[model samples]
Target: MSFLLRLTSRLTGRQVGTDRFGNVYFESRRLQPIYNRPRRWAIYARGGREPTVVPPEWHAWLHHTVAEPLPEQKRYPWQQEHRPNLTGTPESYRPAGHDYVGGTRRVTGGDYEAWTPGA
Candidate 1:
């Protein structure tokens, strides 16, 4: 966080709520002149700067999609739990033929022949 944000948040921000990840959400005390709506923002949790760390309800509130944060509901058994993005991390998924797993890809028999120029 920068000094300007800290100062602005202190002066103009109101505590809205914190997400399960510990990210703090705030809304401006006064509505912004241009949008005519209070500005909303979030202070990410430590090591939780990745945007995907935010749950769907919190994300909606931050974007002003809803007047208030949605209440939590019981998840269905078939529903998958939320997870942060892991594209560049070791925990990310790798296909069977990927270089990191193994360079060789298994060959399957095929009837198609390679094309040649005019032959």
Candidate 2:
């Protein structure tokens, strides 16, 4: 699959850059026809939705802000590579102010607990 992707990219030949996440990007090899709309598409790890899914460093690369791929030998003190969110996974973050386990809301004095029919 990777081989196929590389071959297609070679044919298109606009590959200006790649990101830390290995997402390769390219501009149009030929001048786009006046009527042609810009392409807004990518193959993501879980699924592609919006640009926010891509973090700041990678966002810059995708937009051509930096000429080189991430992790250039000369490290910038502030520059950090992209890291995709894992909100839905067990490894997701639960900060000090956040809730890990939910408790039910009860206005009245009632034993509010999770529903289990047999229990």
Candidate 3:
């Protein structure tokens, strides 16, 4: 976050909550004249500037979909914990045939023939 933003937030923002990722949520103490509602925003945790790091519950709150963040609800046993996007990182997923994996795809028996334009 920039120093100007930090200063603005501190001056006009009222902290609403903090998420598990350490992100802090806030709302403008004074309502916006155009919208007649307090503006909402977040201070992303270190290394979490990617918007996807904001969990679903917090996302809804940030967008004004709800008056307040929904209470934490139980997750299904099959549900997995949230993780930040890992694209471009070493931990990102790579298919078996990707160059980083082995650049060569295993060939299976022919399943069909290529189609001709008019045949």
Which predicted model would earn the best lDDT?
3
User: Would you list the C-alpha lDDT of every candidate in the order shown?
Assistant: 0.84, 0.54, 0.88
Highest TM-score against the true fold, candidate: 1
Q: What lDDT does candidate 2 reach at residue 119?
A: 88
In Å, residue 52's CA in model 3 sits off its true spot by: 0.8
lDDT of 3 by residue, 1-119 (tens): 88888898989998999888898889999999998999999999875368888888899999999999877678899988888888999999999889999899888678879889988
lDDT of 1 by residue, 81-111 (tens): 7788889999999988899998778896698
Stretches > 4 Å off in candidate 3: 108-119
Backbone clash pairs for candidate 3 read: none
TM-score computed on alpha carbons, candidate 3: 0.81
Task: Look at candidate 2 and tell me the lDDT of residue 94.
Answer: 62
> Can you tell me which runs of candidate 2 are displaced by over 4 Å?
35-55, 60-81, 94-119
Q: What is the full ranking by TM-score, best candidate first?
A: 1, 3, 2
In model 2, residue pairs whose N, Cα or C atoms come closer than 3 Å (at least 3 residues apart or on different chains), thus clashing, are none
Write candidate 2's Cα lDDT for 1-119 as tens digits: 25675577667656665555555555556644773533322333334454556656556665656654455455578966455666777778766544564544435666777799988
